[model samples]
Target: MMRHLDPTRLPTLHLSRGLVVAGLLGGVATASGIALTTTSGWLIVRADEQPQIMLLLTAIVAVRTFGLARPVFRYWERLRSHDVALRDLAERRTGTYAALVPLTPARLGARGRTDVLTGVVDDLTDVVEASVRVTVPAIAALVAGVGAAALTALVDPRVGLVLAAMLLATAVVAILADRLESRSQAAVLAARAEVARVVQLTTEQADELRVIGGTGSAHDWLRAAHVRLRASVARQSRGRSLSAAAVLVITGASTLACAALASTSGADAPVRALLVLAPVATGEALGVLTDATRALARARACARRLVELLGRTPAVVDHPEVEPPSRRPRGAWDPLRRTAHAERGTQGHPLRPHGTPRLELRDLAAGWLPGRTDLGPLDLTIEPGERVAITGPNGSGKSTLLAVLARHLDPTAGRYTVDDTDVTHAPLADVRRLVAVVDDEPHVLAGTLRANLALAAPDADDQVLVDSLRRAGLGTWLDGLEHGLDSRLGTGGLGISGGERTRLAIARAIASARPVVLLDEPVAHLDHPTAEVVIADLLQGAGERSVIMVTHHHVGLDRMDRVVTMQEGVPSHGQERVPG
Candidate 1:
């Protein structure tokens, strides 16, 4: 029963000094309630007597003190507990985000990865919130129950024995309620996750679904998910309802027993009145245990889900030497970027073998999933200073090959070497540092224009950045910007056109100064003239640099030094280099 209530498996939990003070304050507050109830009872009985007001003074003062202390202590407890929980939540979120960096896109599902990541944040918050909801409340109830039993025993031992029996019964009810809640909690959590997934999928893919006439199917899916969520929540609430009813029944029965016992006692009337109210007060304090149990069940469910998701082995692993800090310097394009405006050469990438990196693929085989090979079992090579174009139909594994080349996917079999150094199993960080890839889909971060460009070349001065942009043909666009490099872009700022965004991505690739530049359909969205212009600018900007471009379009074939067409996963014919 206790195992189901623990949430220590959550990665982001941090225990702070405030948590202890909160629990102690909560317990003291509960004790104050019991004291207030017992003292009020004494005051009522004393007032009924034909006695002087002075005789009732102490009881009145005690009642007033307990009443005042209860709210004050409770307020302090709430403040402290929330402070600790929020701090723990912040730390946990930070650590979880850090841990997720390595597991991105590959281990995370290719579809709806954003939704899954967003849901993890909400789940982590619930687990952290349980410190206040479950732990502190249970501590308060225990303290109040113990204090009530002790006071009753001092007045009459049999009444204390009855109170203990009542507490035990309450514990039994709590355990039963927890079991019921736990049974439903997982179902509810899974339902909520499904709803989140469905909603995000519908929202993100609305256009695609509409184009394919899947709008009705998507609506049906979302509706079904919502229905299941509603049912799951209703089922979970039943346990809470049962818990509240049981607590009330126990309170009533215990109060009656306490009153009967007090009537038979030879103790003074005022003491007996105090004894009678003790059971009722204790029951009120224990009623909050239902909320504690619900919190425990919810937190446990969230933790269990996180445990399963986070436990998966990562798709990529770093080699031993580069596992801690990357072998390359932390700087962007470290050991690569040059002081000059050159995109590639000895001035760039000092680590490049003889100042030019050779990428060779010998029978490389890899896939998106296990047992499904999509690329290779064939050999290919990108020689130094070569400009190569690969043209293939859809599903010919062009993207998969690029994924392998970029170190986003590992080769399942065969050798992939860089400048004669076999890097099939090299640290991903080390391999990625030597290659620059610009795929069809580019991301524009929400930041200043300079901030967006700086990601690819952090140390690049304004002239270098401007030069790269000019080479990518963003020269006209730059001239129109009032803020120049400082212009805010993305959401509530300058909206970059598709052509401009494509040019911006090209500029980033040029500015990166990596030894090898691999472009995958860089002109996918451009018209023929724009495509020709962009491709011409690309070849001119990449003097002496190794460039491997994969494209389905045929607008700029003349500029490529060599062109190879592929069918299935293999090169259809011999690689053909254009006449000099």
Candidate 2:
């Protein structure tokens, strides 16, 4: 589904027509430069021959015309290239985001999922930047190089051949530089990502690190990361530096050869002088090839990484044979006795439309890795409005179970169904839309409270938002706010406490229209009292929806309809580990 696997497929391919125009404009700019230099040389040398002033006037005019046209054409080229590049960037970002929507929280990476997503954002930017930084430059260089060779050859064949050879040598040097830099690009990228991760962790956890006396360990990590980054960058730069030197050497040789040929030729003094200077002008024009080389290498590396991540097959795909019933099953236990009453609505929804949402997992064993089941070959059913809490020790697959339920992970061996129909192979998007996940570390985005809350329910009014916040245990806090819902939060704004953050996530889940709400240790980061308050408020409004919460600690278990604790090393599926 992705074109980047070919290694040659670039985002710029879509902007071919625009890029071609930019390249042609660049060629004109470069050819004008060669013409200006050649004509200026002709005018100066011919005037020294004591020819009539009118004889030099034509050459002078040509020089002035070329000089003026160079800047005009160059400016137009820049405008066209940048416009196309930015447009391509927008499209690529949009497409990439759409592709990632289905892979979130699962394929993104198990730990530090946010960091993995952030890295992808940066990597995607780099891939698009290649259009402006790498591909456009390469196209312009090719166009300019050819224009110069053609112009010089038209004036004198021998100097033209020398110009062509110099351009060829420049191309060879650029290729060598690209190879040298490409080898270090991946290392440099990895080192940079690591360094970024360390800095993010150290800065965010400064207080915790200091309290645990792990500040020194964090500093050591930073130092090691910095060292590796420096080494990789230095190695990467070697190619560009070498290419620059080679271009200079080639320039000198070609210029000298042109001069020798010019002096021996029987051409007029004006023409001979122009030929001698053409090769020097051509060399100057091609000097920027080194930068182009570096950008190309960097872009290729970024594209390869992005393709590797985004091009993989999604974990869950829809079952083509089983279509979600046209409508929700009409009130069969609302969703309980779903043997009948399922009716197709005007809107197409997942199969088994009807009643209250029923999620059933039978012998559903799944894990992050193959051949290693972290969860059930067990059975469980969450009926409509059922409040279930799954508690277990670490590595007992609490989060793994939640992930599978949310359709983020596929079950390895069992049946997961909604409303009596197996939905293990259901459309991931449809399944996920029915579930809202509230995880441990909740993010308060850098926006107004209204903006953050509205993300979950865009069509919700202010009253609904205030109610949601109140229901999530932030009622008193909301009433106290001067700006109320308009108040800003997150970085560069008002900072919220841990309890507030957890409540905010709860409020968001409450606001979402999803029928199934999965909480993965929603209160794990909160203190005991705050946890109780949040739990009380979280369950208050979830009367009509199925809520499944996974936690290691038994917090507010009495309020839940059922509490199931997963056990480690149960030795077989369907056996709930009971402590002796």
Candidate 3:
């Protein structure tokens, strides 16, 4: 069962003191602009009376001061707000990534895992950016509007009432814009993700699609995705357009009202002129309302997605009452024969298993989703150091079973025990520590060869790395490298053939020295002969470790001690043992 989390409870959505201070600075900048407009109007009107030049000196200096203060305060506000937002972004990204690690490949959905990760990155950015785009402007507008109305009220009550009404109407318009933006942002986000997924799939599978005569259908999908994106964008624009039109209309009416009230009052000509220009200045300052509303809507949507993704319960749980396996010296179970150390553990000691553990599944059942069994209701067992092959077609549950064996998933029913200990009562890290997984597309990070292999056993020495590579049948390849372990392997470095890539994945497992290795279609992309050679090297390289290979092909089944054929969600046919 998955737990649902409230997105509003996330700490990232809250504003900090730094943001509030920046908003205050922004308000000062806006207030200066409004003051400049009214005072300049007064200076111009008073000059028409042909007064002495000395009478205008104070007004002239005040206008110049306001002009200079606006830009200075605005620059400071930008620096403060962006600095705060960027720091918060770093913290949020780190936290989100940590939360996602446990739910990978299972709770993240079967397909589109890459798209899910990409969306997380983009959404986190939007949530952080809202602090600057939405929060700062909203506070600035409130401060400036209130100050304008208060100052105007001291002059004449009627004109001040008109300005206050204008501010209230702008707030109403902002609310309407926010409602409209909220209604369309989700559609726009979905349309954009569809377009991206379509383009990426089409480009990456171009050759396969062409061979299977799916190119036309692929193009049709791309075209449909583009059409949806355009429609969503068109709908999203309505809110911005409405806010702009409403602001302009409201400003014109308010200016007329202020002018009428001022003209009938007993105030002088200069004072009346100043009163008329106040509404016009305030309208320009509030023009940022539309952009701020849009940011708020988009940020809310991004936050919702993040919460939904991170709140799901992990497929496997580590029971708090269960303690991790106690440490034992290498070869403790069979002291008659000394086993060579594999990976270095804490403080440079080896973390090798005492001996290989037996695995048994008794009518086990499991699924990626609730109420849908993808595997089992069958019995199976593997003795120490045995090699087995699970042969099945797609949807026959081979991969799901492997996920259970690797401790990446929890079984829904029945019992699974490792060396007579039930897996559910064992700590997750304890079971996972004994297993290594090698898949078809093993990621080759763009770095040095040593760095890539060190991901499995960070404390292993160069000699250990060389030994593992040699065992995987890469001794000749390593000798040819100019820099030995320092040789780079991924993009912009050295290119690897399909056979070499499979061997490298095997080498990583060998270096880790876990007691069991689960290979899920490790040679799915390789040709017949290449697949055979890779499998031979992998099995040989694993040494005494138990090996379980899941595949539909019969390329290397002849070497397995047992072969189990599965149908639907359980093993159906009698198992076969072939002579090695």
lDDT of 1 at 146: 82
Cα-based lDDT for every prediction: 0.79, 0.76, 0.85
TM-score for candidate 3, residues paired by index: 0.79
Candidate 2 per-residue C-alpha lDDT over 500-538 given as tens digits, one digit per residue, 9 for 90 to 100:
998999888877646778998898767888888788888
- Please identify model 1 stretches exceeding 4 Å from their true place: 1-18, 38-64, 109-111, 266-276, 319-356, 378-395, 435-567, 571-580
Cα lDDT tens digits, model 3, 204-226, are: 68888999999999999999999
Clashes of each: 2, 15, 0
lDDT of model number 2 = 0.76
Quick one: best lDDT, which candidate?
3
- Number of clashes found in candidate 3: 0
lDDT of 3: 0.85
Local accuracy of candidate 1 as per-residue lDDT tens digits, 214-332: 99999999999999999999988887898899999998998888889899998889999998899888999999888888878888888886766665566677655543434455764
- Model 3 alpha-carbon miss at residue 511, Å: 5.7
Q: Please report, as a residue range, the 10-residue window in candidate 3 with the lowest summed lDDT.
A: 334-343
Residue 291: error of model 3 in Å? Answer: 1.8
